[model samples]
Target: MPLRSVIKTQNNQRRSFGRDRSGATAVEFAMVAAPLFMLIFAIVETFVISAAGILLDTAVDDVAREVFTGQIQQADIKEAVFREKICGKVDFLLTCDKLKLDLRTIPAFADIPTDVPMKLKRVDDSSFCFDPGAANAITVLRAYYEWPWTASFLHKLAADTDGNSVMFSIAAFMNEPFGDRLNSNANCS
Candidate 1:
């Protein structure tokens, strides 16, 4: 073979090898970036939702404690109080207006059917009010939160049209705030 032809053949092979690797990195990056970005976003969203739920649960527990202790008057157990005291703490993630608070008294802990109903009870007093022979009374406080899912994919896969509504409840039995003089109608005086 001629020296010039041999040199040309070598150069052509080198050019073809370089061209083959040039676009490979870009294709690999395109393949990997999309799913990686999606996974990161999903992780962040999960943390946000979990933090919101924890904050709400803590707020409900605190409010229910105040109610049972007679620190908050029965009349104050309205929507306004929930908005100001509970929802106010987690306004960044949840809307106070969308939350529902229900308070009830249960005859026994066993009688409380679900977290939705049990957490709504403001005053349990079952331990203090019940006869020694009778089943202990319990207070249940139910807090229903209508959480709105921000991610479109999460909404489509995990949430309903009304958004992801989660109901959280906290219950405890303690002495009645007013002892024997406790009147169901009267505010804590």
Candidate 2:
């Protein structure tokens, strides 16, 4: 073929290929992929928050067992010690420094205070309250963690005045007989 004819044929083929609709699906997918991926990631993040909640509850229960059985008291546990133990077991994604705790030992379940003090309420990054009470005492343990909120609705449900979502766990039980039982007042501060 002549050089001029070859060039004309090549240009025509290039124009046809450019007009071809075969790649339209790919273009459409590229356009839609972003929102789809975002939705998927949002779902995964939601599941993660839920799993973290369950894991937080589990960790609290595990630590509260020691407190209920007087093991924590026998070892002379402090607030920092309790926080360290729980934060170590809970989600590493969470900021451990913002973790807050409130523990009070009531004399009897009937004597348990009506007020549920520790909640995902106001933003208080103060110290943890450590009061396991005397032996055989009814211990009320409340743990609060200010979880980072990605979804706005989560903040609406569990978030404090701040934007962070709050996670709470409560456990109450009497101490075991492994330690010496002593009489202590309820409503520990």
Candidate 3:
């Protein structure tokens, strides 16, 4: 072909290509798919984590009420039983094995510890203990769980070495004077 005709043909093809809108929507959607999916996953994961935390807090509050009312006495329920009860109540998104419980009596309400543990794995850790105090005594109950991140890209959200974040709930109250004050040596598992 002649040079002028070849150049004109090339320009026509370029214009045709530029004007074609056939797959434009698909291309635009493809470009945004990854980021859109990531945002959705982040929102969903945050919601589920928040819900699990709320469930855990509700369970702790309910169980602590039992202790406050002398329904969960050292003489009646074992530590394992108490733990099972809490786990049962939080069965929606949390596993029982990952749950940790610490129930103990404080010298006074003002003596309640204000620190959260830097490392937590099991209920047997030094930071965890089981001791239901006597009637009218001040007590604090705490629960913890390690929430694993499902998305690899969200690893930065994890706070623990195992690539998971910690969820915790606490309840503090003075036990209602119901049971014998002497029956306070409760063991927690």
Candidate 4:
């Protein structure tokens, strides 16, 4: 109970506490957990986005055939019908309402526009131009969707920052000689 003995005991207790390894597991976990969880979430998000991209590409490939073969034009398939077909072919997770499509047919392949549009820059759907030109013309089809996300970082990484990532698919091909598309008043507009 001397002052010197009390000081020595306090120093020894402090040193012991500093060297103690009892909480090492929690400390190590804390150091590793943040990065580990981030990596896991990133991987999951990457997988999902990749899957969506594949699905979109597959749907475009399937639907583009109808356009190339003039089936869509011959049937006079309305714009809504074409959209409905595309939606039916896509995954259930994709909201059909969010799908935006742009289909353009040019006189020749050389005349094809070189822009890769992903989202609707303008809000007016009526303002869009759709020209599924005559038979043997080159047609380009583009579709866009905003996939919702719960992960903040992934959303910020996306071109759109509202916790939504823009997913798009494109297809270009020459219309087969099924019939003269110019003669048919395809209601693609």
Candidate 5:
């Protein structure tokens, strides 16, 4: 072929390739698929975690009212009863065995400890406490739960060594002076 003819053929092929739209949609989707999926998963993870936290907070508040009014303290087994009450409220989305509770008397509102760590991978008796305190005493109740993530990439959000994120809820209030909390009938209803 002559050189001029060869050059014209190459130009025509280039124009045809540029005008082809058959694979454009596939290419565009491929380019955006990864980041798009990641964003969607992140949003879902955030929503689920937020919802779980809210549930935990509400459960803690509701159950803590029992202690504030001296109902829990009147129970024969204060710790066990308190745990069961809290678990009943939050068991829909969270495992009951994985729940941890800490209830103790605080000298004053300012004395409430804020530095409690969540690094414990396994929830156990040593991981928390239960001290409902006497009537008219100030107390703080805290609950901790380790929530597992469906997406492995979300492990980085975990505070526990087991690669699960921690959810926390707290309630602090004074006992209502219900009178003779310990000697009263077990009215932990």
Candidate 6:
């Protein structure tokens, strides 16, 4: 073959190889980067949600402790006790009126009523009599918190997919911290 023809064939081969390699970097990038991005985003979202849940749980336990110890009175039900103790302590996580605290004294596990009121009342004042044998009676404090999602995208996802409200309930139980001691004659209705 002539030298000119040989050189032209070599140049043609090089041009074909260059065209084939053109998109190789982009394919490699797509393969590696897609899953890595997803994994990173998932981890960040999980951490945010878990932190919010822990904060809400802590707030519930705090409020329940106060209710069981008789530190909160009927007058202080929603406004004073809940506002100051629970909602105030949680940083922008919960609101006072948005929370519902229900304290029930269960004389017997069977006596625990299903229709529990959504208020904090003195268990002693209720017509429900306390049984001494049931001193191990259960005091159920239910804390309902409406947790707003920190991420707008997550909020929309929850609403659209699960139809679950942004609210969650955390219940803390302690044996009636006070068996039968009625501290104040003040009506805890």
The 10-residue segment with the lowest total lDDT in model 3: 118-127
Error of 1 at 183 (Å): 8.0
Per-residue CA lDDT of model 4 for 48-159, tens digit only, reads: 8788878888898988998888778777766777788889987575778888887877666777555444335322344344555567888888887777765777766654
Displacement of residue 35 (Cα, Å) in model 1 is 1.0
Displacement of the residue 16 alpha carbon in candidate 3, Å: 12
**lDDT (Cα, tens digit) per residue for candidate 6, span 1-189:** 999999999999999987885788889999999777866776786676567668877877776666555555322344344546666766574456655555555555666444533223211223332111122345655554544544455556656323223434445454454445442422224
Best by TM-score: 3
TM-score each candidate.
0.64, 0.69, 0.79, 0.74, 0.77, 0.51
Candidates' RMSD to native:
9.5, 7.1, 8.1, 8.9, 8.3, 10.0
Q: Which residue ranges in model 5 land beyond 4 Å of their true spot?
A: 1-21, 118-127, 157-162, 183-189
Kindly list the per-residue Cα lDDT of model 3 for residues 33-54, writing each as its tens digit: 9999999998899899999999
Candidate 2, superposed: residue stretches over 4 Å from native? 1-27, 110-128, 151-161, 181-188
* Order of models, best lDDT first: 3, 5, 4, 2, 1, 6
Superposed Cα deviation of residue 151, candidate 2 (Å): 5.1
- Writing each residue's lDDT as its tens digit, candidate 2 over 72-183 gives 7777755677778888997475567776777777667887544434435564534345687777677878777667767655556553446665677778888776667432
Q: What is the clash count for each candidate, in the order shown?
A: 11, 0, 0, 0, 0, 0
Candidate 5, pairs of clashing residues: none
Candidate 2, run of 10 with poorest lDDT = 180-189
Question: Which predicted model would earn the best lDDT?
Answer: 3
Model 2 quality (TM-score): 0.69
Better of 4 and 5 by TM-score: 5
- The predicted structure with the larger lDDT, 4 or 5, is 5
Ranking by TM-score: 3, 5, 4, 2, 1, 6
- The clash number for model 6 is 0
Query: How do the residues 1-189 of candidate 5 rate in per-residue lDDT, one tens digit apiece?
Result: 999999999999999998988998789999999989998998998898899899999999998898899877776454666788989998898899888888888789999867546435644436456777789988889888877877777886554547777788889999999887562322222
